[model samples]
Target: MTPDLEKELDDFKLSHYENADFDSLTKKTIQLYNKFERLKDKKKQNRVVLDLYTLYLQATEILFINSHALSVTVDRFPSALFIDSFNLRNFISENFAKTTELSSWFFKLIFSVLKDNSGTNEKYNLYTNLIKEVAKDYLGDYDLLNAYKHGYRVKANHSQTTLSISVGNGQHFKLNDSDSTITYFSKETRDGVPIVLQHTLNFKIGRIFGKCLFVCSLLNNMRAIILLHYKKPVSSKDISSFYINDKDEWNSMFGGSHFKQPVFSLKGLNKKNAIPK
Candidate 1:
């Protein structure tokens, strides 16, 4: 590549990173965190349920977008600019597995630099596991998200509601209540017996917001590593510095709860004879 063209490409790459607005994402996360805390103590149960569901969906989308940003930074792939959950899921899966040739190459390249700069296996594993957890949380809610996006099919079910169905041929299945915020049901068939797949997603409001903050921190950390790999200078005042220095404050504010996995059950077939009006 010619020197002038090379410099132009370099400038473009730097500009892209600068314009990602990760700082804004961090601020939004903090705002959502405060909102979640306040909403938890309110007396209106129905309104609170809707508010929490909205917040959880927003937080999850932010996490997915941040992961997409990180993937683009790692490989400088132009196609990654467009946000598609299907592609994002593949990227997350590939990175977590780190077995494919492309994933192995990039994974080693990125983490090797991280290891050198941080110089600790503990920190390395911590970040690695964080990525894995994020991937799991995102993929686990993929169907619920699609339900929201495609047709707004999810319903807010009251706490302690059980979904029981009778599949034909004497087979029956039930989904006991777990106090989830929203529930989604879809129809399917299993061995000639119809069944309804029930999907329930529950979130500890604080932890959901915490995962958003976690995504912001991971994005900045990986951005720095990617820039370093390309020999680009990272500023001392970068967003990563704040997260690294004030880890305790955010950790405390977000609390220590792990991400709750969404529940799925195949309840029995929808048959006119199965129910009494």
Candidate 2:
């Protein structure tokens, strides 16, 4: 074969493998969750948390790229090579906000699938609320992801004492374990007085794993919906055609019966402590 043909074949193989990997995100998340459950060591748990954090970020990016592709007027589905140009936070705020067109279509399809698979409104709402919780967690803890990705600025908080900072004259800011398990600090000035800003975020390992799994499921189902309608000459009125016809497949892949909501917090810095010294 010519060199160009060989290069084409290699690209095809790589693309196929990456697509398969993307589809396996739900399974990979479950495997990590199981591993976390089986491990009892603190260090192991921390390792799992870091892994989950990485997976969560990747999944978020994939979902955003796919969602953006679907939102446009033309038929442009995202491939493995497609990189999202917008920052994750900005993309979510612009496209996934409560009032956005993409948000409406995306959540409608997700809720439809959940309701179909759940078999009852109660379970559907439970899963819906869980997704909402995870999305909120993603938005809030995004900065922590940046800290980890950029300069390795975040660390697991192992200290027994609450971190306190004196803003000069009498006021103080305190951060405890309850506030976050991971912490980072940066200095800034407010009205000529310099103060330390405590950036913190925390998550229960088990819950983070569970939330990641659910998010993967959500993205998987959304992708399925996009493909089902891809390039089809359908109008907005033909919404019924958009539903996933394979209920059993969806039930198996997007099931939320065992999913758990994430309990996490991202506390940036105390504004009250920014007083002039």
Every candidate's lDDT: 0.53, 0.53
Candidate 1 residues 204-254, lDDT tens each? Answer: 444455556666664565566656757778775453521234566435432
- Candidate topping TM-score: 1
On residues 202-229, what C-alpha lDDT tens digit does candidate 2 reach at each position?
5445455555666676666654454444
Q: What is the C-alpha RMSD of each candidate to the true structure, in Å?
A: 9.0, 12.3
Clashes of each: 1, 0
Candidate 1 Cα misplacement greater than 4 A, ranges: 1-8, 40-76, 97-119, 155-180, 185-197, 225-237, 241-277
Instruction: Look at candidate 2 and give me any clashing residue pairs.
Output: none
Q: How many backbone clashes does candidate 2 have?
A: 0
Instruction: Report the error of model 2 at residue 33, Å.
Output: 2.1
What is candidate 2's local distance difference test score?
Answer: 0.53
